[model samples]
Target: MEAFTLSSDFGYVVLVVVATVFLLQWLGIQVVMARKKYEVSYPRMYSDNDDRFNCVQRAHQNTLEVYPTYLILQIFGGLYAPKLGALCGLIWLAGRVAYALGYYTGDPEKRNRGAFGYIGLLTLLVCTVMFGLSLLGFI
Candidate 1:
């Protein structure tokens, strides 16, 4: 573990990223526990026949699939553009939440409600390029 001070923009982004990562982990736990509730035995088979289970499970899996890229982008991007990184991180969090809620409890046809998270992801990707350019003194 490294000690950090949150006074700089980079540190602030780090804080936001850490918080978002924690939430993703928490969501994962929620889904795991939820799956357990669906099964007759713990550590049992996985099924998605139930719409509710499928919804949450899908949301969890989808988030997991996206989380790594978000984390990597956040870390490298925040180094050069911390404020933008923070904003993008927050947006990603919001988008993921909207995606999960819409997927878990909202209409099936409205899955696009949570798609805004991609904008944040793209922004981070650009920021990553910025970081790379900064390292190369091209920016």
Candidate 2:
């Protein structure tokens, strides 16, 4: 059995930052939802009409929808260009955080910008995959 160490590139830093953002975003949503649930019954926990709560719920849901893809891209991209991939991942994380904050504050348009950030991440992932496949002579 062998342990895997990430390549020595700046991309690892980006991955770390992205992971941190993901964790923080997740924790924020969980803390809020848990507190709400504790205050009320589970069935009605998220039934509140407060705009902030709705915003947070939507943000969390959006994160869930995108995080998996982001993770896959981050890992593959890191393999090819750790520094560049990490930078892109960090950018994506920042965009997501911005989107969350904007949504939380009731700015719907800001979410689109965050969505756009995914483009960079996706590009990096695709390049990484292509590189990996070529390396393995699968291309």
Candidate 3:
């Protein structure tokens, strides 16, 4: 196995990582803004069981839940499948955005509209595991 050269190969990984981080940060900011918009007061922490706040917070938490796995799969996969990994990462970002929008609408039933993001996440997971195994001489 060849060492991952930090030239073009690692460059693609960095690009995708940065983009993913940016997307995640953007979503987090939106959650904070939602807190403000919904009148979830500061220092209180909890949303007082408010439905709008609940939806917004849950949408944000949902993203937080998947972010770590997505980042790991994305960066690891990027190391082996740069173009495809980046493309999938972009797709994942789009999925997260769709999920957020669907979940943010203050409707629990409509949240499934954003569920499509998992497809991208699963694809990334497969790519990462496959490439990772190969890198480990297991393939």
Candidate with the larger TM-score of 1 and 2: 1
TM-score of 3: 0.83
Evaluate model 2: give its lDDT: 0.67
lDDT of 3 by residue, 16-87 (tens): 678867777887787688778878877655587678777777777778887888889987777767777777
TM-score of each: 0.82, 0.71, 0.83
Better of 1 and 3 by TM-score: 3
Better of 1 and 3 by lDDT: 1
Q: Kindly report which residue stretches of model 2 are placed more than 4 angstroms away from their true locations once superposed.
A: 1-6, 10-18, 21-45
lDDT of 3 at 15: 81
Instruction: Report the lDDT tens digits of candidate 2 across residue range 55-109.
Output: 6667777776877787777777777777777777777777777777677665666
Candidates sorted on lDDT, descending: 1, 3, 2
Model 3 spans > 4 angstroms off: 6-10
Candidate 2, residue 81: how far the Cα is off, in Å: 1.0
Predictions in order: lDDT: 0.78, 0.67, 0.76
Cα lDDT over the full model 3 = 0.76
Best by TM-score: 3
